[model samples]
Target: MKPLHLERCLRTVEADKAVLCSAARVPYYPLVVKKARGSWVEDADGNRYIDFLASAAAVNVGHCHPRVVEAVREQAEAFMSYTAVYMYHEPLVCLSEALCRITPGNFPKRVIYGLSGSDANDGAIKLARWTTGRSKIVAFQRSYHGSTYGALSLSSLSLPMRRRMGPFLPEVYHFPYPDTFRPPFSGTDEEIADYHLDLIRRAFADYIPGEEVAAVIIEPIQGDAGILVPPVSFMKGLRSLCNDHGILLIAEEVQQGFGRTGKWFGIEHFGIVPDAVILGKALGSGLPLSAIVAREDLMADWDAPAHCFTHAGNAVCCAAAYASVQVIEEEGLIARSEEMGNYLMERFRALQDSYPLIGDVRGKGLSIGVDLVKDGKTRERHGEAAAKICYQAWQKGLLLSFFSGSVLRIQPPLVITREEADRALEIIEEAMRDFLAGRISDEVLKTVKGW
Candidate 1:
């Protein structure tokens, strides 16, 4: 593919296409991708990039993973789609069993399927409300679940995401989620925990009664909201409160599940078992598939056609998801993620020593973020600077993404080797240093901002 072909593709997109919305936070970097494998992606002009963003984390097992491709291809040959809502499907049952074996919870559990994170979230929350017979729900500020109406109502990540999408689900309340680097409330970890926990306790009296709240939905590692990770104390506080009030707890792991966070689930790091877990993105290794795994009693009563998606439980996707699980386990990608994440963070912190603009480097496992700021003390969000880093990174054959503005997000595929991690990190450091030395162009800086 030539540069002209790439330019033509870009023009065709703008002229012939109309997009209702998007979650990608950076300006579109124009390089028509031709193929990808493992952690490397080749664009139209044959420029290869270390895929740090991993296609919004959908291909965690790596692009065109042989096992996943084989599974989907084999399933497609026999049958493509099946309505599990009506008849039996072996792949669906096998995938359910696999998830049941992996997902937390000692009691009897069941799996409910959907086509995306948003729909799974809706199903999980609806189940919580129905089973518990409560109406109100609680979500955190700067949290993102999905784009659908019910999930959007619970999302506090972006006001633009909810703008003009009026009359969202009632009683969907929001509270500030704690962050270590940003420090939403100033103090030590204990003090931070106490301050945020007190707010939740007060919400019962001031905002909405705790008794009326059906569930408290949260991401163990906040994804779209700059990869924010709350303190363990805060997580335990929520768990205790849920237990005390008989409210259900649902952990939305759409972005953080399936070894993306070094563990089977991000919630595992916190050492608390949620009543339900929402999974998507990497489950089918690039295919669209999401599921809500919960206690048997909670989901055993959800009858079919009550909540139906025509493509839900598609045989090929289920087969792919099952293979993805096997591939992750057989290949030891989970352990690899843990090892590479620590190495990546260490490299980032080393880079931070030379770059003051890199104010904070924090993450567990592969979901890491480098928060750029004007100054360490003032902590003014330098979104432009971060975007400039992304601009330079793309030019240097590295795909980087950021959200909201300040935090440079790095969610590479789990199958990425130390060599790939080092390559991407070197590009990141090189890009940052170049930007600092005034090598970044004014046009690039201008376009990277206010997107």
Candidate 2:
């Protein structure tokens, strides 16, 4: 088959099977990736974009970092899957130890492995309920946990994400997560903190008894719900409440972990240590791996084989994840992410001053969000404008995403240099210019709106 025809066939096959799951199918960017390295992605058709998306921060060490690839390759020479449940594996043991050592909490910690952030979170909930003997879980209104049944019940980022999905896990309650850009219920920081804090308190008082709640799961920096950074007071308040009630606090750090937040974990920025930390995305570079790092005492009671799975610690994936951590350490990418993040924020704030459509800019490290608005006064989500801007950028060979219809997610790989950052910003500025000058047409906006 011809190359173009082959690409079309692949897309058609996926489109027929995608079934409500959208993973950049069809003419989104004409990118049928041949390969990727570092922060650059090249299409089969030879188009290259400085990847600001970074596969949702999964390639923090960069796509196919040499160390991670070599680790996977070297491990493949020995074996691929030993199945952690069946026997011993050196890589798995090392990775687990690395996790226990690096994750927050001075107390002895243990690690449980999984294939995705969803299952890891589900496992965390299971452990919390089993350990605490409680059935109820507290989640946030605009938070996205994952796509699993339990996670869907917890997520409120986009209604369509859960529409007709089903009656989700019962006893999962939603409360406000403070948003500095769009304050919870539109109030001052202290007021927002107090309101959400009371909402949790009252949930235990009148709604669900505090004794019945097992865990209060949260995304330290809300990723899919438009990159919301909660007030520090709100997080401290939640920690205090959980302490008083004996409810476990689980921080879902799948997207924000692995130095994507300029720190090893997003919770570090909040100056809090969650009882358990859930991680994924960058855990194995581009490979599928995730883990739950919990206090030893917290996981000490769970019986074996209760949560054992076949591929939780696949050998090659473990090696990849281990190498990924090493790369982050040896190259000092965490500090790099922090420095680059600071520079990006400074540049973005200056651009915000020039653009009236940009309502707010906020992020930690490389995880950034730009809020688009219809106007400076109303601050209504300018979904159409965001769509236009993203399409204009895509046409100019830059890949980013907009969620909640108006928030531009600008998560570049940690390996990004100052020059690459400038190039990406130039593309964004040009796209914004197109939108402002009426060059971004209604037809282009309508065409990609559903995407």
Candidate 3:
């Protein structure tokens, strides 16, 4: 295959550097997208590639989906922005009702909208603190919530996100997240779960009493931390502990919700209902929208204007979100996610037998991770190799990204066809082969700073 020449893409990247803030960029490759539809994206230079990153797992229903596009178009034509804080809008109400219906909770639920995952998480913090009359919040290490102050305080995924920024929210605590593959404590799956849960239990008893903790925020499937999916016992034990202590359990479903995990939400896989669920990435099918679905009482106590954004429930964005939800249900994308996720995992596991670089394969549904390591036994992170694979895959006409230094995140849009997925798998293997054969060089990595 001829090597990709992204001249226009490179030029566009240069333009971005000249105009865009460095703080806003975390680019893995010079993939200057011109147009995207369904599972394919075309570059500025007219080169086409399969989209596996799904715009950082936000386009679950696919890019430019007709239903979502039409909803945006129609809503924009009627009116664009509305001060949802003070005004009533049909779209907002409709979207809220839909969220209440779909989210994992049998109890009465209410919805709060925001423009991104950051603000939604921020809102959840305020509500959790206010409702419980407690100040402390607990989050997992290597878990990402968002960049906003409250969310940032809860996040400890990478030091770069927090460097020189905090003095974060006081009383916010971090604990070990159970990682079965790289068990934080040396033991079996059950032992690992108990060990981590015991740490939290000990913290409640020795240091911060659970009574003082307002909430424990968690990602059902930690997205930015290399798609770390915790064991069921850990999650269940955490929930029980929260219940015993009266600390609210907030599920940050920003990246793993809306059928991306082969269910309505990732928490469903564990058969647990969180006190609140934070949603964002795919809620609007690529539009700027997020939501917090919580129990009615939790939302009721926190009155209006206390946590309101002027465009929190923007009519157009709500329309897009509503249509996006419909697309997931009508197109049966949730089930498709499970089926394709299994197929992709099977194929990747088969490839693992041939590639020592593949150290671990783990995830639920379409939210999978391919951990790369220098030595399989030692399990040392091979960020260099992961970067090379991503670069090679991009050059070979596939779009994807790596996170936590070395895990190849394999979350494509749920609408991806089997044929596209097979081709993507082939490109991934070819990239690995290219890396082992020295076709991908260290020089190629100088420009990209992937996380």
Candidate 4:
């Protein structure tokens, strides 16, 4: 391993702590990044590591991709940005058309732009409410939409995120998200689907009537909640339920879009098309951009200046986003995601045979999660092991994060090569061995508090 020279990195972190607010931070390691290229990152201390988190799955095409960089450079040279609300730009119009065309939906679609997933999601909620004239919104338990007030009201994933921050948008309701591995119900996947669907049905019948609910927003694969992949039956059932009640179904693809889930969108895996698809993260190839593609008629009534922002659809960001989409298409990264995902999961399954702590390995495409358990029969969560493994992996030149205190988040960029993947697996296996042998200590775990 390259010796860690922490003087520069520590200095940077201390400087950041002096000025930056803690509310905007969720740091897992102290490694300060100086530069990143493709699937690798160089820390301020000059240590190189393979980046498996891929900047929280926002760099699906890999960091600093040539096309994305070139697009940004070209757009910046032409002009920086003007308020898109009043003016028209080629990059904005082109990207809007591209998103409407690629996202799942046969109807005429319109696009709304924003600077982050939270804002786009907030816009979606407003659009749903405006279109249906309903006051209530439905979301799943342990699902994280965003941090903005409207999105935060829809999120129930992190307690820390919601603590002391209430009177969250009234009329918002949350239901259980059917997690197949640690399922709420004791039966099979189909049974679990039925159980959650019944809860919604009963809610509509008794308390929150479906007619009052404007929309049901969900992540096709719950990212922050440990990469939970609900049964196909559950997604289809939810879609049908929304249809029966005239409730708009919004697919939150913030972390799972742009070829991260093997398909263009994660909802495509379940064979269902959402009324509105939220796109962010990988959509902009590291630029600040997010959007929602919905039916044209749904947004026809709500015209400009309603949910507009000053820098929502900046031209340079739109150029980077369009280039990112083109790279995913031309390079066949979507198919590559599937092939590499299968390879990585197969390796993990083999590793699980030797390591009993691994309770479950689940996900689609590059967005996989490895759940660590205390016991095979009881399947109790082993968050400590997850933390130690991540720390050890970092020590050995691999970078990743864990979620819900137990599951190891394994979402690497789609551009990762087989050789690089094998190396990362080796690092993880080494970390696992170290943890099992009591090589990693609690002193190290104290350095990071993972959510």
Give a tens-digit lDDT track for model 3, residues 94-199: 9999999999888999988888999999898899988999999999999988899988998998888899987988988999898877886578888999999999
Compare candidates 3 and 4 on lDDT and give the better one: 4
Distance from true location, Cα of 220 in model 2, Å: 0.7
Worst 10 residues of 2 by lDDT: 1-10
What lDDT score belongs to each candidate, Candidate 1 first? Answer: 0.85, 0.85, 0.91, 0.92
What is candidate 1's lDDT per residue for 19-62, written digit by digit as tens?
52335443546656789999999876667889998888889899
Residue range 6-110, candidate 4, lDDT tens digits: 899989999999999999987777889999999999999888999899999999999999999999999999988998988899999999989988999899999
Q: Over 4 Å off in model 2, which ranges?
A: 1-28, 184-187, 446-451
Cα lDDT of model 2 by residue, 175-294, tens digit: 888876666466788788888799889878997999999999999999988888888888888999999999999999999999998999999987889999998999989898988999
What is the clash count for each candidate, in the order shown?
0, 0, 0, 0
Higher-lDDT candidate among 1 and 4?
A: 4
Which stretches of candidate 4 lie above 4 Å from their native place?
A: none
- TM-score for all models, in order of appearance: 0.95, 0.94, 0.99, 0.99
TM-score of 1: 0.95
Candidate 4 at 282: error in angstroms?
A: 1.0
After the best TM-score superposition of candidate 3, give how far the Cα of residue 8 lies from its true spot, in angstroms. 2.4
| Candidate with more favorable, higher TM-score: 1 or 2 | 1
Off by over 4 Å in 1: 1-26, 445-451
Q: Candidate 3: which stretches are off by over 4 Å?
A: none
- The alpha-carbon root-mean-square deviation between model 1 and the true structure, to one decimal in Å, is 2.4
For model 4, the run of ten residues with the poorest summed lDDT: 1-10
